[model samples]
Target: MAPNDSAQTTEEAKDLVAGRRRATRYIVPVAVAGVAAATIGLVPALAASGDPDLPKITAQELIEKMAASDTQQLSGTVKINTDLGIPSLGGLAELGGGSLAPGGERGESGSAASPDGKLLELASGSHTLRVAADGPDKQKVSILEDTAEYSVIHNSGEVWAYDSASNEAFHAKDDGSGTGPGKEREAAPKDLPTTPKELADEALKAADETTSVTVGGTAQVAGRDAYQLVIKPKQSGSTVGSIKIAVDAKNGVPLKFTLTPSSGGKAAIDAGFTKVDFSKPAASTFDFTPPKGAKVTEADELEKEKGLERGAKNHEDFKGMEDFQGLNIIGEGWTSIAKIEMPGGEGIGAPKDGEVPPEAEKFLNALGDQVDGKFGSGTVFKTRLVNALMTDDGKVYVGAVTKDALVKAANEGK
Candidate 1:
């Protein structure tokens, strides 16, 4: 099932966080960055070596070259393998979030390509088969799983994702939406981290030392010739200074990429292009139709709601029964100030205050003393605290903060 599926979101989040505790998701991200860096930096050196005649190509050029072949409608199969590393779940783990594990099993289907260079087809997975498109960036792929599940219309910078399961569609400016119609390309760092080539350029520029060598070998897959290219990292502390990619010598596409981490781990990713059909794909592949009575919501609003829901769920999961039981009400006609005060005198949670309330400060200080310092490392006084305190006083605060100080202040009843 997809990670976003209702039943799996919680469990997936759990497993993902656990995976991070193992190696911290750095393996794949760094590897990706390293691959680009290594290629960008090492390719030149390789070209400079005895094989001086090999044409000079920029990292971007290489990517374009791989993507450039036969722009006029071509079809093939794609087998994508990604080995990613997740970080520890210390506070940042959930904050940094995690990546979706590439669905297991190879995809098989008759695919087609369009004149505009779009590849569309139905993919067969172990459980559910998804049909999607490889948008302009290739990485900007979209899942066209159920035409009936979502009503997507792209026009004048508007985009929507209507879910058939819940009967609600999320809306956001097309700029943030990938693929789909009228969506603007997002900027980098913010955009899905740059492609491998961009990372390669960055790595090459920053590399302190460079060397060139041609490790010989070639293999044929999908009727394409692939070459083995290896480049080593220069810095001792670098996560991955070395990378190897099996590039399709004939088509300029990559079939395999190997990353060696500085921490002594090995990861190999294989991408297979199968069922190649160069015929022009259908024109309706990009079209989408909405479902009936779907609730429409802006993307940011959905995100805000998701965050709030997650936070509330987290509070229920972590907050002790004693927390709610201990507090009582006071005040005649006064409304309640529900704030999430952490253990330390740090930040407050929900119902953000333009100015810190006196009770919030006291609550944070009092809570701070209890945890002593289990929240985080630099978090000796810091702790994850949610304060939803109500009193006769007109004050409130919520969210992450230092628990110790809050505890201290609350106990003194200051």
Candidate 2:
């Protein structure tokens, strides 16, 4: 074979591997995010006009109801829309042979792309999710795109993830022990704030002198009666306006969540169920078998051991980090800020000596404004809903408020 041809083949192989990894990263979070949203009964629909005659409830009463909400067998379809205002990386789909393209998994390689392709689909537009829960431990979530579908089924201690586009599947068995490959099998980070109830709980925990909670009113979502709970940050520097959650009137489950920035024209992130059914999904829904000729990866005992070791090391490393010591919350509730002292070039994938990679610097410059302050030179990345400030001095401040809030937090050094 010609040398040039060999080089091209090698490059192509690298791209394929990278594409697979990207797809896994993108698809898993989305599916798990769907489950988190679904677990809280966050099915989306346009909020119905307010009902003045509905019984008005206090904020404390609403919190109690949410705490006591029933979560059992249920199924629903959710719609997720996110507009982060980040420019799309041009030709990402083409570079990966349309593997990241939305709708109909057809790619230049004549194969269905992985569910990660749906990331491109959701980045700019809307997507549909179907979720069902049999109990706390049994659940299924499926993401349906125009031409591709990704489904995860967990039942009877077995978990299976199938991608229709790639004709591939992954299987893992939970041996009732929480420590193993089954532990690493989770696609989404357990710490992500995905659900309305979870988000509300976090906010409530942070609510202090700087925040307030109020009952926003009553409305209907997905044909079910719901009461609106609103959380607002009192700090003037906060860029956040308020967060609103629609709680199911009957069960106290949250049906929808919306985050609106203080200077906001629109909700930056809107996720919820578009439709829902209280009826339990059939048992067959969780049943899955790998299709003929599909690639399969199973998590055996050895693999489980390796996963356990990696998790242990990761946990230990996190605990051993001292750079973040003395970190404190700057504000409370929706606009709260958290600042951490980072060692120069020590963050994940960070370049040495506090140097920013050219590509990343360019991207950050485009997305935010550069500034110098007592904390050091840094860039403040701002979006409709969140803001982050990273300094060359190895400090990081982030908040769901606005750029000003992040800046304030950065200036008030620990």
Candidate 3:
């Protein structure tokens, strides 16, 4: 259940998680798609174990090794396979991605990859494959064929991704760098934190009470000696069911990662590295100067549409309709219009004395909060207790934003 906006319940935190979900499906996909930024070229980094013959180590130890690496510049692709996977409800999983296919609403892939967690740096030459096992959400592995084009760079406190195709560079934070070229891109801060260990600690804390294990093997990835590590969660929990991250044993750079579920499903990510250049990037790589007339807008600002926000936020107002009656609420526009209808009911605006029942009190209370005491005013027009709810959440009760659209849909339904 979504929390009320009054800051009482942890609903706002849920909203934040919801927002991250959208960003993943939208921003990450666009950044990782098909665009390579020039100016910056460095081979992906990996740690050189003091002793090559050392036995398998913990995931946290591996991350610590990553933190000490100085390599930069690499390129590759990855595919993730899984068997059982649950729909992402909280965090960035809610980006509305039913599947990784065309026409499906896309989300950012990086939401799953935070350098602050089990990672030090995600570079161009790095390839990661995630595999899962279980439900329909994890039936097959998604092969991210060629992903060098969407190279997101992070140094110190700055994050920048360059797309050569569009000649546009995006910054993770608001650094005022337009979506253009010639502007100076920020440098990797000297005191930047690269704590994969810290991130791993958080992961263990946030994770369910279960012990996870890792084993090691070898495989050839992009013609390199890659080390394979398998991580199996002891319990059947929703987070990090099972994961496999393969890193180049020679260079210690990650080659691929696979995440799977315990129920038996699949999701895979396979990254193939093409080149690893450790040379310093050109001076122009850090700049983000937009073109003369290229329009630029913040992603958050663009999502603030009145209609869509109203629809999503009020959706909770429409649940539990086993005994809801039918009455017409004041709809905007159109005279004598019946905006909504149910299987066994009529549409007359407002409650007809005893129309509303006590069971619906909670639902109506939610709506009243949105109305902000505007009910009973002429502006609110009419109130109704419909037999059918508009959404799965008992909120969003079911009234047309405009009388015209409501009539159109009702007629079309008939």
Best by lDDT: 2
Local error of candidate 1 at residue 273 (angstroms): 4.1
> Which stretches of model 2 miss by more than 4 angstroms?
1-53, 88-124, 177-208, 299-333, 344-364
Indicate the worst ten consecutive residues by lDDT in candidate 2.
103-112
TM-score of each: 0.36, 0.66, 0.35
**How far is 72's C-alpha from truth in model 1 (Å)?**
8.2
lDDT for 20 (candidate 2): 96
lDDT of 1: 0.40
User: Candidate 1 residues 20-108, lDDT tens each?
Assistant: 87676678798999999999999967653442224444444454445444343444555543332322222332232322111111111
Q: For candidate 3, write residues 1-414 as lDDT tens digits.
A: 545556645676788898999788887666655343321222232322322444566666665455444445433334322222122222222243322321122233222222121121222123343222121111111223254243344333345444433333444453443332113322332344435566556655544344454546665555565566666655322223456766666556666666543333444223444333334444334434444543333333323442364465456545524345454553222112333434344332333336688566444544432222212211122222111223211122243123223323333433
lDDT scores for all predictions?
0.40, 0.69, 0.39
Ranking by lDDT: 2, 1, 3
Query: Candidate 3: where are CA atoms >4 Å away?
Result: 1-63, 70-209, 236-241, 250-252, 263-279, 282-288, 291-294, 298-414
Model 2 per-residue lDDT at 164: 83
Evaluated with TM-score, which candidate comes out highest?
Answer: 2
Q: For candidate 3, what's the RMSD? A: 27.5
* Of 1 and 3, the candidate ranking higher by lDDT: 1
Worst 10 residues of 3 by lDDT: 132-141
